[model samples]
Target: MRNVVLFSFILLFVLLIFCANRTTKNESSSLQSLYHHAKVTSHPGYEHIWPNIEFGWEIIVGTLIGVFGASFGSVGGVGGGGIFVPMLILIIGFDAKSATAISKCMVTGAAISTVFFNLKLRHPTLDIPMIDYDLVLLNQPVIILGISIGVVLSVVFADWMITVLLIIIFIVTSVKAFIKGLDTWKKETIVKEEFVKHLESTATSSEDVEYKYLPSCPDDEPQKKINQGTILSNIQWKKFGLLCFVWIAVLLLQIAKNYTATCSIKYWLLTLLQIPVTVGVSMYQAIGLYQGKKITVSKQDHGTHWPLHLLIVSLSCALLAGILGGLLGVGSGFVMGPLFIEFGIAPQVASATATLGMTFTASISVAQYFLLNRFPVPYALYLTIVATIAAYIGQKIIDRLVNIFQRASLIIFVLSFTILVSAIALGGVGISHMIEKIQRNEYMGFEDLCY
Candidate 1:
């Protein structure tokens, strides 16, 4: 089976190059005409879609995506689609739909490489119990369901549906961000005396403990205090309620807009995106464990009642979120990571679980996209091979600098988010000309231009 798969991929790669070249030759004139039209139409207004050379900048950008995805995935225990999809759309001139499709295709290589690297290193045990086995079984059915839905939608109304979905998602994300900012400001302004008093008492108790005592001094002398910081109470129920309400509102909006169909395709793509990101997250966790960082485990088990039910629910919700993220061109782990955290999973475990879950999501997505003909088999194969190889190299570099560069992943996430949001806002107004001109020199041929 492996040999067959490899041979099939090789044949596909050759076919993709041949087709791309043929298309370039035959369609160059038409493409040039479209470019001129794009220039004219885009002068006063911005276009959501732009054109560029597929094999030129796309390859370079795609490689960069693979590298970053591998590097961060090594550290974060999540796939790098959150980084890659946005980069592809904003930097590589792919629309969100095409970016999602290509990202799904590309992530396979990175994810596979990361997983193999982690296995080779014999990283620390997951420590989370039988969650993996449970997930493996539960996820397959949900994924199959999602793929069935996505394949139908992709064939029937992919382009139009994606455009409409993007618009709604943009508006919702903007509003959610603004609201979060406001809530943060509100929380900062409020002062809770009870919370403060609790913190003070906790601090006092922690500080009274001693780590060591001097032997030369008086034996009866008081030991020096060791200060362990206070633990704040869980967030207030009112605030939690408000947050839940906001989430529900967002969910309702999505449902009313019938965007669930978009998730069908996205869910499958998410499985592919999970590969490298999960390995990265796992590696980081293993390093933390090696350094004696405590790992948390949930006491709840998959018993016959609520515990089992909750596990199933959590896994299902995660699967759905992964799909949604893929459709949104952000990747599955970003959304899954936070959701897992919210469900009282330890942060590291949450990151790891999300990444693992995403692997399944991405695998299914890649297959669905290929089946739907959204990606040509040859191009997909070439991309997969290149990205996978690059991911292995990238992971080696990450392992060498793990201690120093783990935090860099968070910084990259923040910066990538900023760039994506900025691109969306600016692209909505057609400001690509400024970005393109500044990033690339004038008089460059179409083949040389960054989309």
Candidate 2:
């Protein structure tokens, strides 16, 4: 029944694409011209205040908040867009749309830094690189597909509706993460006590009591160990090639989308092409995992033990999380981080893997924003650099703390805290904005994408 339902969903999406293309020849040029006018005359986002703000002390204060947000978000494997967007809008004094673009710029920097660190690092117990490449291959494409859907809905849904949904989802996900963290902390305590007792009974050295699953490493680990050569060798090129192919395919499609007339045959054709690219690639990976031909190596010996249903559910979760991110204007990291924990992944590997995929999506966003000329180059560049440094430092500090305390649950706590803060901050911002829109007697109904 579930497989049938899932298949039907994909089929429906495909059918819609074909249906649009079938009317390609019937679409009149005048209709196309009207759409072109809409694209030129109106902004896709809700609000864009005047006065050309984003200067002065705003930059200094925004930079400070960006540093804190990047560090916390990076350490927790969330993209920190929740904090970045609000900071950009309120402190930096940018409009909503530009704030989102610059927010992605910050996310791109942080994700790249965190992913680079994870690439040359090993899993806590497994020999594989800390990132779960197979998981990325399976999850990312569908997440992108869902994001496209969410973007469409974002255009149509009123601000208040999205805000209410965001608050509910974030709060629920955060509570679940807190509970998971408590469970993990208790388990760690029991293990620590047992290890100490065993050492006393056997008169063993502390080093001999090191657990197989702990991320224990020499404190003197050299930076040179993660040089270009080591990083290249650590990567699984086959999986990476597939991931890159998906990224490039989608990127090219979006570039093509810009040249075509809005809502025209060419535009719809380009838009619909993404379905095959995203769903096709994700389906390929999902099937491979189900058939035991591939694995999420960070899962240790249990990688190949996944049932078909579990694979379907995971792909579905990725889609759902991606859609939520799109609707709420938050990063996928906020949703994906907690979801990965629930998938029973170790917090260390989960954070790394989620951020690895975020690197791809964030880069895509930055590229699109650049194409749209949405932000000033100097500001974006400066913020990006700040985020990169902050993320790198944040990851290092978190790794040190976790290892010192032997508590991976710290990452989960950070994830929960970040989500909770986002819920309160963003929810409040949206509610206030919604009230303002109401005061001005704005339309609160479905928006026309064509207009």
Highest TM-score: give the candidate number: 2
> Which RMSD values do the candidates have, in order?
16.3, 13.3
Candidate 2 lDDT, 1-451, residue by residue in tens: 3563355346534533543564464455462321111122135444443212222366657778987899899988887888898888787666777778888999999999999887777777666677888888889988887777787789889889999999999899889999999999998899888877888899667655656546664452332233213688779899899889989998888878877777789988888898899899989988888788887766554587678778878888999977877777677777787888888889988899899888888788789778867676656776787788778778878887887787999999999998888888788889989999999999887778777
lDDT of 1 by residue, 1-451 (tens): 3563466457546645764685577565564532221212211353334344344555556656655664555334445554556565666555555556667766656666655554333111222231232332333334333343343343444333444454564445434434443443343234233334556767566335432211111232332011111112212244224323333332333233232233456543543443333333333433433343423233123222234345456546645544444344444554444444345433333434444445555665665555444544544565566566655555555444422322223322332343345336434423444346547755322221112
TM-score of model 1 vs. true structure: 0.46
lDDT of each: 0.43, 0.78
Q: Candidate 2 — which residues are off by over 4 angstroms?
A: 1-55, 217-229
Cα distance off (Å), candidate 1, residue 67: 2.6
Q: Estimate each model's TM-score.
A: 0.46, 0.86
Tell me the lDDT of candidate 1.
Answer: 0.43
Model 1 misplaced stretches (Cα beyond 4 Å): 1-58, 73-78, 86-97, 121-131, 136-140, 143-309, 312-316, 322-330, 343-349, 393-451
